[model samples]
Target: MSLPLPATGTKRADRHWWQTACIYQIYPASFKDSNGDGFGDLPGIISKIDHLKSLGVNAVWLSPCYESPNVDGGYDISNYRKIDPRYGTVADIELLIRSLDEVNIRLIMDLVVNHTSDQHEWFRESRSSKTNAKRDWYIWRKGKSITIGNECVRTPPNNWKSQFQGSAWEYDAHTDEYYLHLFAAQQPDLN
Candidate 1:
């Protein structure tokens, strides 16, 4: 899915540098504090692009700029279409995107698709009473009240251990069900 290479013999910021274009990944909070709010904003990013350019990185990848609850380090996105208020307004993202475009530097963003933070609407509803419409959005099973049928698969359907070194199932209070967890109890597996 990669695009075609830039035209040959082109006047560019970095030549022969395409093979070794300067690529930079910035963690906004640690990069700069534009508003002095202890968080990095688009202006902060724009201000630092020169430093990156000086470092010879021809491209940049932003960790995450979309709106989020900041749980799981912003990997749990609340709204992909908006920028987190802690960061800046949506205009900031657009300005950053346009600025990067003008400099011929590519901008990459982190995309999160796993279960969002508990505060996210999906997880909130999934945690509600068992009959909630979004309950099935996450994996949940009926509690241990069922007697196994003759062919009922059980015991984790095998002996596969969760990476967290424990039984994979977690008890849910809402549905009195057991949900699979691939990590800590707090991080319910979205699989």
Candidate 2:
């Protein structure tokens, strides 16, 4: 089933720029590495503004480059406000934005909010204790306990599976609870 296209000769101002923009996705880790660190960084991206413009790119969707433990390829961000040191600093990102703006190219960041790195301050506090002030920020449950052969064992909160495979819940011995993780064990789902 084909959808009807917009009427020809429609005024450009009548539609959102994104409706007809040429967007390019850049995985900063694999893009140009300006520092020779073997990983792409913001400065590297900034250095390619001319290349992006020459490619007729109107927008760039940058993958996550937030501070993380790299357990989930930066998707498990430890800090949402800070850029990973390996990728450069916040100032570098600001420069990248301005550079892209110079070429009329928009910048879109891949912000992962559904879950955060286990090392994230919020997640760390949430997992510290059941009564932690931020405990409710993440999904936690007391999994069922089963007796097997004379030993008692705790199982996951449920039989749900993770997208990356195995159980979706990780057992926290400190809190004696199972936290939900849709992706990696290090990434717990936000409440």
Candidate 3:
């Protein structure tokens, strides 16, 4: 069957919009501010939908707005279900999605699951005790001892460096083990 062609000469069915769509990345905190709060909010994004459309953007990939400590610029999520107050309320996000939908613009959110905030419930429970049921959720390796100028010092399990320019593993005194953190010490890598 022949697919209908739009004014842009692109077939509706033959062309996957996701493959050809102009998607813009919006870091909400650095974007427009409608409430003069010095931080971008959902209403700010809503007001800029028209500007994005004018710029030929059909989709937007939004940065993390989830509840976090902002250790990694909101990438270390503490609660995936809750929206950070600095960004907006849950209802505000819903409104933003609906407003974008009205203008035929798709909204996408960033999903960072490589590691979560140490304050996250799962991480907290996992680190509560070595025998905890969720202890295996995060990688915990035995620390190694290295002599530095005749002084023996406990070191991480490996010589790997974190992306943030530090040891990839953090020593947890409570658990007496070194947990892998590809990013920040607060972000332990999930097992």
Candidate 4:
């Protein structure tokens, strides 16, 4: 995986209009579930916008509402192009967007391009045979160290600690090398 580095002389800072609009963050799963599947869906959130609008809120920051494996509590996203099936679908989000617009309320969805659900196609390919074209999408390095017949089996380039509770190195039997995992052993850092 790659950590996109900023240009040598560039500074990028977000300054959206909503920065001063004063909004409330909504954790959809805990908001409400009309279907009672123990998981909240878009319809449930839509049914309650009136409550938020009445509260004088203008913008809503939706938690990781996109499809996820629920790892990292949905913050570790899987896909960037669609809505999570458990919550709803693209159409559901579209309707919510339109409805919110009618009330002058803004809907902001989360984008997690980094590590994805292991089930995500990106991660799937990343963990697959290293020769796969999709492998470079994420950071994959050998174990703490490697050597084959006197040649170095090149480990990850850094001597860094995994932010997660344990060492970041994980051996992949498929590729005979260790890959980096900055978070949970399963939650490898996103590119």
Candidate 5:
């Protein structure tokens, strides 16, 4: 798509268009269901563009609709470049963007770069071994061994608590190390 031209006679110091845009946030799963599949999809969102226009929405802040395990309400993204089948396909997203653009509405997709699903290829390879090329892509640390009830137990590297409760680090038996997750263990923190 071509870059939007700046408004005529608008000074650089002036507030940008987005500074005053009326953005409407949409969580696809709970917004509208187009196929009766019990989940909202991109097509369903497209079907409501008229309603959004009537509501004077100048932009849409779409929540993550990327391929995910839905462990944290689709925040555990398994793939960053692909759309989840539960929502729709890449074409659907393209159409949505184009449709929104046609009506002078901007599309803002929510991207979660802080962490990725443990099922993601990057995380999988990172946890494969300490020497894996992508290993440094995530935060991994050795745990402190403590004696507990006659048996040696490995505790998290630090006393950091996860937002979802419990230790923020999850021990990986394969690599004999712990990976940090600020949220759920399924969503490992990316370095």
Candidate 6:
């Protein structure tokens, strides 16, 4: 029922640093707000570096801070390569990395690739028309309405439920199809 532990003597030092390092997770939006903007930015995290160092932390893991609609608290990313304006600029992130490195703190980012914001460029192009170049980038399916006791019932492609709420698929009026979203309607699963 239990897995065997690594050799405790000589093998202890051979293990990766992550096996023993204390990693701290920070949700940037709620961590610290710089510039009185009421939203956390890379600079805000940089300002707290001393606290992390004093806490004996080795690495810092951050949730998604990419450009997004924030429909799912920044998980619905609109752009993967750009930082959200509310979070600061790419230069600021570089500064944060350098600052963390000065204190021996590794920076880790949460990569949310299961799905993306419906407003993402690729999603927009995909939904623009069925013949679009990126139309196959996202899941799209036809749905049917079932008649039960005289009442017509329209449902998603399947009975899959969304983690956020309601059905896992949202009907696109323009595309005349339903797209799968494991979380919120704003986040459509990639094909």
C-alpha-based local distance difference test score of model 5: 0.95
Candidate 4 structure quality by residue, lDDT tens digits, 1-191 = 96555556543354445544768888888887879799888889899888989998889889888777786778767777778788888898888899899899998776665567766778788788889888877777765457789887656546676776656766678887666677766666665
- What tens digits encode model 1's per-residue C-alpha lDDT throughout 44-112? 998877677667677897887777767556666666788888777888888888888777788878776
Model 1: how far is 42 from its true place, Å?
2.5
What Cα-based lDDT does every candidate model obtain?
A: 0.70, 0.93, 0.91, 0.76, 0.95, 0.92
Between 2 and 3, whose lDDT is larger?
2
Task: Put down candidate 6 lDDT per residue, 1-191, tens digits, no spaces.
Answer: 96556675847578778878899999999999988988888899999999999999999999999999999999999999999999899999889999999999999989998999998999999999999999989999998889999999777899999998899999998988999999999999998
Candidate 2's C-alpha runs over 4 A off are 1-13
Assess candidate 2 and give its TM-score to the true structure. Answer: 0.92
On lDDT, the candidate that comes out on top is: 5
User: Candidate 5 — which residues are off by over 4 angstroms?
Assistant: 1-13, 148-150
Listed per model in order, the count of residue pairs whose N, CA or C atoms clash below 3 Å is 3, 0, 0, 6, 0, 0
Cα-based lDDT at residue 52, candidate 4: 85
Report RMSD for candidate 4.
Answer: 7.1
Q: Per-residue lDDT tens digits of candidate 5, residues 79-147?
A: 999999999999999999999999989999999999999999999999999999999999999999999
Output the lDDT of residue 25, model 1. Answer: 83
- How are the candidates ranked when ordered by lDDT, highest leading? 5, 2, 6, 3, 4, 1
For model 1, what is the alpha-carbon lDDT of residue 17? 56
Better of 4 and 6 by lDDT: 6
The TM-score that candidate 5 achieves is 0.91
Q: Write the per-residue lDDT of candidate 2 for residues 1-191, one digit (tens) a residue.
A: 96566689988887678878899999999999998879998999999999999999999999999999999889999999999999999999999998899889999999998999999999989989998999999999999989999999888878999999999999998998999999999999999
Q: Score candidate 6 by lDDT.
A: 0.92
lDDT of 2: 0.93
